[model samples]
Each structure stands twice: as structure tokens, then as C-alpha cells.
Target: MRASVTITGSLEDAFNEWTEGTARRLTDVTEQAASTMRDELRAAMSTAGLGKLGRALGHAGYPGGGNYSIHPAAEVFVRGRAASAAKWEGVIDAFNDGATIRSKRGWLAIPTKNCPKGSRGRFLTPDQVAERFGPLRSIAAGKSVLLFADVIAGKSGGVRKATAGRIAQGRESKLTLMFVLVKDATIRKRLDLDAVIRQWETRFPAMIADVLKDG
Candidate 1:
């Protein structure tokens, strides 16, 4: 995603000072927008129940082992000596953005093809899935299908374990809460671009004054 901020105001002398300062301050201003996007996206992912991946998101790294980037989207520009514009970029902000295929009967894996460009699947590792749904008690796993039984209550608050019974491997258990398809607009709502712009506008004058004072 990309967001552009354009500053508009009367061309008075005082305002000219601010606009000139804004042109020079484009980098810092765009950085602030990026910062806002980062924070907002993190919160949105958490709310969308993808907090694990969100925690791994970064600004300056290749996407692998859950690490992703949300760097600057485009170049900053000063248009006609009257407006200053900057674009902020984002990726990995979608919940239902990619496709995946199961590697095994239980393990959900990223397919080798038919995936969105620059996208990675958020499937758990085999070990993780085993941990959540205990490892097969049977020695022959591939011989038959497997399913998790209900959590049997432990006696006297002790830890529960598989009871001495035949675990009939007939069908595979489905992961109910595997992935959530949160809408793009739902994630965008948290960005609150208007608030970000308003904040920048509210502080631009003071920022320009400080620059002038220092100059």
C-alpha cells in the first residue's frame, strides 16, 4: 500500500517559510508517516490474531523466517513551490492475502506455485503442529488417517496423557482457527491517515519555527 500526503495553504510570507521548510523536511515528514504506518499495522495485525507474524515484521530486512519489511514507498516531492508531497509504502498488511497448500495430512505448507508475488504463507512448522495436536501414538502414522481426541479430564488435577485404548485412525482433524481472512479495509481503518495528516499539520508550524530558529 502507498499513502501520499500533500500540504495545501495560502501563499502568504509566513506560510511560505513553512512550505519551504516542509520541502526540505520531506524526509523527516515521510519518516514520521512510515513510523505511524508501522505502529498502526502492528496493532492491526495483533487485533486480527496474526500477532505472531506482526512481531516479526521489520523495516530493513528480507522476508524469511517470518521477518518482513515496511519501508518507504516512493520519493518525496515539492510541487510548484506551493505543495510538498511524500509517499509511504507498506506490505504484508493483508490477512487473506496469500494462498497455501498442505504439505501433509496435518501440516499446512506454502505451495510451490500459484502464490501471490512476494508473499509467504503463515503455516506452523511440523513441530509446532505436533505440539498443538500431540504426536501420533501409533508407530504407523501414514498407514491410516489420524484425529485428535477430546481433552480428557485429568484425575485429581494431574497432567493428562493418552489413555490405554485403541486410537482408531480413520479421518484427519481440521484446524478450525488456522487463518483469519481480515478485510483490507479493516486493517486500513487502524492506520487513521486523517489523524496522521492532522498531526503533521498541527506540528508543521512548530517544526518550521524550530528549523528557522536553528538556522
Candidate 2:
């Protein structure tokens, strides 16, 4: 985001002072661009109004593990607060939407009831379904899972002898929950999965190094 500060002094004086100070402070920093822009904006702010302000611009990278860039700009006399608020809101919305997919090593496994005793077919509760499938609970959280009952389907193919016992007892058979083993963490992230796997490679570099060393 960019912001400008007004200066009663000449534009050249303001620009020179601001640029030198900013360059000295942020030449090699990770946020060099943003820092420089902020300094320039502060210089402009020292001036009374937007009329004496020069241009200031900044680029803030994504706060989350996603790839996003925030560019903000404002002239003098304009309140920077509104623009800053809007930029922050945009970032929050992006995070809420789960724009980036993260990866993990293992999968979330859930077990469901294929059939209950005394029922001709198998049946599974929504909770059981969620336990087997990772996304069911996430999608169902803060709302009624019963509302999604229509979408749940069931099928039968292989049955264990013990499971068959329950089926013969009149358990209802139905598609309880869809089981999906996702190898990529990105899929869950897209589904708005709560957990964010960040810095996994860094955290597990020893294991990765071993694999690489062997390979």
C-alpha cells in the first residue's frame, strides 16, 4: 500500500530527504519496498495537506501462506485509515476464502458404520460420516448437518463377515459418508480446512535431507 505525506517544502527537498532516509533504513530488508513507501508517506504526512505531498507507494505480500500482493495508494488530505482498513479487510477475506492450498504428510481417516444390528441395511450417522471423511465436519460446522442429508449416498460391495452379521440383523444399507484420501494438502485448504500446514519442509528438513541423500 502507498501513502503520501504533504510537505510545505519544495518537492525536490521533500523527495530527496525522504528517499535518502528510506534507502538507508530499508535497503536490504525483506520488506524494503514497503518500508521505503511508509517512510515517504510519513514525510508527506508531516506536510499540512495533500497538495504538498508527493506520491508514495507500497507493496505488502500475503500474510498467510498464500501468494498475494497488496498495493495501496493515497494522495494527501485523504485519510489513510480508510484505505488501510480496506486493504486489511481484503487480506482477511482472502484468508477466509482459503486461497492457498497447503500440503501435509498424512491423511485424516474416519470409520463409519456400514450396518447396525437388527437392521437389514447399513446406516451411518452424520458424525460417523464426518469421522471417516475429513471435510464433512468442516462443512457442517456451525450449521445443521441434517440439512445435507439429501446429498449423502451409500453403496454396497465388499462386506466383512462380522459386518454381514449386523446386516442380516435388519440394519439399513446406505452410503454413509464419502471417503476421500487426499494426498495433497491443498485440497483440504480449498475446502476451508482449519489446519494450515506451514513450514513443513523447514520443520522436517532432516527427513527430507535423508531422502535426498539416499536418492
Candidate 3:
């Protein structure tokens, strides 16, 4: 779940010989790469069926004397959703990892009465589900999920604060899915860290070379 690449060689010596501005330039490059990585990771999760969690994904950076570190993570509110979040993660992993899910009770069904007339008899995409329930203005996912009847009866007041808080904070219910998606082969290839680091490796030398030339 974690990866890092260290660049070593005469490069360090060259950086040491250069001005402080050169070190700052290297840090800028690292921060930019980290930003891109975080964005791509969020995008990949959205496409991999974890879009709901993308809102909570964020990144930060720390600069030291000659290096910087980027941290991309879900915030405290997202971490608070461990229980139901785990259940959803299991469902996604079971499907992605090729583990079959069988239920004697039959597919967990949702009523289609809320769907648009044309969408009534078919499976609805997430967008369609959102549209069908748009009047509710929010979804619940902790101990209880927002149900059709709850929306109908306007009984979501109790969780309305929690729902609104999540929305305002841009946190999502199923965040573990983002972590799992990062490890997935297809997603990993698309966000390949090694390739990103290689590009940085090539650029680092050129950056120092440019600084030295200016000096």
C-alpha cells in the first residue's frame, strides 16, 4: 500500500554543490508529482466503482532540507465510517478478486417505483439511482441507509445532520474501496509509481544541470 523511490549517486553531490534554489526546485517537482498521483488515484477509484469515496481523498506535502514527502489520505470523518464501509469494501473486493457472492435470500433488491418510467424494469446505474432519489437531497450509510420509505415519509431528519456534515466535509461512506482500488492491477498500472519516479529521476539531473548552468 506504500511505495517510495530514492535517487542516489553523484546527483546528491551535485545538489550539495548547487544553491538552495536548486533544492527548492526539486521539492517543487516532488510536490507536483504527488499532486498528480493523488488526482489520478482519486480518478481511478471513481472509475473502479468507488467514486463515492473520492470526495474524501486528499493530499499534503512536507519539505525537508533536500527532499519532500507527499501524503494522500482520507480524512478523520471518513475514517469514522469503518463498519458499514468495510461491508461495502467486502462486496467490491469479492467481485474484483473473483470471489462469488451467493445469497439464498436472492439479490438484495431495491424498489423500482422511484425510478423514471423508462428505467423501471432495468438495472439502474449509480447516476440513475441518484436522479431517482434526488429529492431526498442526501444519502445515509452508517447504522442505517436511506431507504425508499424513509424518503417517502420524510423521516431522514435524525440523520440529516450527519448526512449534511458528510457532504459539507466532502466525505463519503465507502472509503476503504479507494485503498483497495489502488492495489488493483489495472488501477496500479494506470497510476504506476515506478514510471512516475523514473520520469522524476530523469528530470532531477536536468534540473540540477539547469541550476548549475545558471550559476
Query: What CA RMSD would you report for each candidate?
Result: 17.1, 22.0, 17.6
lDDT of 2 by residue, 1-215 (tens): 99998768698987676655443333223244334444544444344243222233334422323322222222222224788756544433343354533236454332234322224444544444444432342234232122121121234654322245456776554433333333332211121212222332243344334433543
Q: What does candidate 1 score on TM?
A: 0.32
lDDT of 1 by residue, 1-215 (tens): 99998867655976667655544454354445545555665666677665654554343212224322222132212122222111112334233343232334453332222111222654444344446445622222343333332222334641233334423333223222222221122233233334534665566556546645653
- Cα lDDT, all candidates: 0.39, 0.37, 0.43
TM-score of each: 0.32, 0.18, 0.32
For model 3 the local lDDT of residue 91 reads 43
Q: Which stretches of candidate 1 lie over 4 Å from their true place?
A: 1-24, 60-94, 104-144, 148-152, 155-158, 162-215
Q: What is the lDDT of residue 24 in candidate 3?
A: 60
Candidate 1 lDDT at 47 equals: 73
- Give lDDT for model 2: 0.37
The candidate with the higher lDDT, 2 or 3, is 3
Q: Once model 3 is optimally superposed onto the true structure by TM-score, how far is the C-alpha of residue 2 displaced, in angstroms?
A: 58
TM-score of 3: 0.32
